[model samples]
Target: MKHLIALATALTLAAASVLFSAANAEANERYGKQKVVYHINYDGGQDDKKYRGARRNIQNHSNAVGAENMDIKVVLHGNGLGLLSQAKTNEALRGQVLELKGQNVAMHVCNNTLKGRKISYENDLFDVFAEDIVPSGVAELSHLQLQGYTYIKP
Candidate 1:
């Protein structure tokens, strides 16, 4: 009777462990495969509360879902292009942007904004490549949504 009871207890513990591990893995997978976009269009400088909040939000999202397990993009246009402009002069803000980029977050700028603002990526922005310039910010947002990316406005 003692032997049988011990065997049953051992089996039960093993089963519980397996079930817990599987559930944990599934939870990770759910977050890991998510595609999300962080949209910024406000016309505030880097010191603005709203702008800072948006950056915090992006970092929080990446923290919740492991950055490597997610596809994250930040669409910058309109006043949002301020980040690029500030990055040219602000070392702290530039460091943060670089950190996010290092974690695989793609930061895009609108070409229309560049034209309207008379800003050149080469002269005004830091780290933005020509390829990262989209024709229109709103249109790019719409296209990304169509491609199943969840949009977040911070």
Candidate 2:
């Protein structure tokens, strides 16, 4: 009985693995290699639910396209900077940012917003670097679109 149960579990695991691989292959075939930019320009709300939803959307997009086959950028400016600011003290938001980063999704902060708001990227935002700063968020979006990146506002 024990052997039978163990065999059933192993077979189920193998079947799940095969199904997952097939799904990934199908997604790759349908989407191919993609360049995508997600724009975040609104305040995520008092509880940051909107930001959380945006993160979820990005994760879904990455999962569907396969991170290896996608170049993803997130452009934040205006009230969108709230995403990073909230993440500083919000563990869940921080984890989401780190997970997206792990998937090679670049988070680009607008230099104009930072300067206008007097916010320091090093001290105010979460895990931002000099390379992640763009002169203007709108310009970055336009540049990315010109470069063949599909724009998504979430």
Candidate 3:
């Protein structure tokens, strides 16, 4: 009886693994290779929950499409810069940003916003560099869309 139970458990585990793989394969086929840009323009400092939700949405989208098959860009402008600023102090938000960065999600900041707000990318924001700054966030979004990237605002 013990041997039979063990065999059954092993078989069940194997079947479950196969099912999971099949589901992932189906998702890969459905999504294929995608270029997606997520837009953010709200102040996370005022409403951290919304910004956190946006991060979650990005992660969920990546998971659904498979990170390897995704080209994800996060365009931040205006108050959206608060997302990274909050991350500097909020451990949870910082971890999420790092995880997304690890998954190859590019975070682009608006040069105009930086100048207008006088926020230093080198010190004020988390993990941002000069290369990450776009001349204008709205223009960048439009350019990305013209280049065949699907726009998503979450």
Best by TM-score: 2
* Residue-level lDDT tens digits of model 3 in 1-154: 9999999999999999999899989999998999999999987755499888999999999888899999999999998999999888889889999999999999999999999999999999999998999999999999999999999998
In candidate 3, how many Å is residue 91 off?
0.1
Q: How close is candidate 1 to the true structure, as a TM-score?
A: 0.79
The prediction achieving the highest lDDT against the true structure is 2
C-alpha lDDT of candidate 1 relative to the true structure: 0.85
Any runs in candidate 1 off by more than 4 Å, and if so which?
Answer: 1-30
Error of 2 at 26 (Å): 0.8
User: What pairs collide in candidate 2?
Assistant: none
lDDT of 3 at 89: 88
- With candidate 2 superimposed using the best TM-score fit, by how many Å does residue 115's alpha carbon deviate from the native? 0.6
lDDT of 2 at 4: 100
- Candidate 2 lDDT, tens digit per residue, 1-154? 9999999999999999999999999999999999999999999986899999999999999899899998999999999999999899999999999999999999999999999999999999999999999999999999999999999998
TM-score for each model: 0.79, 0.98, 0.92
lDDT, each prediction: 0.85, 0.96, 0.94
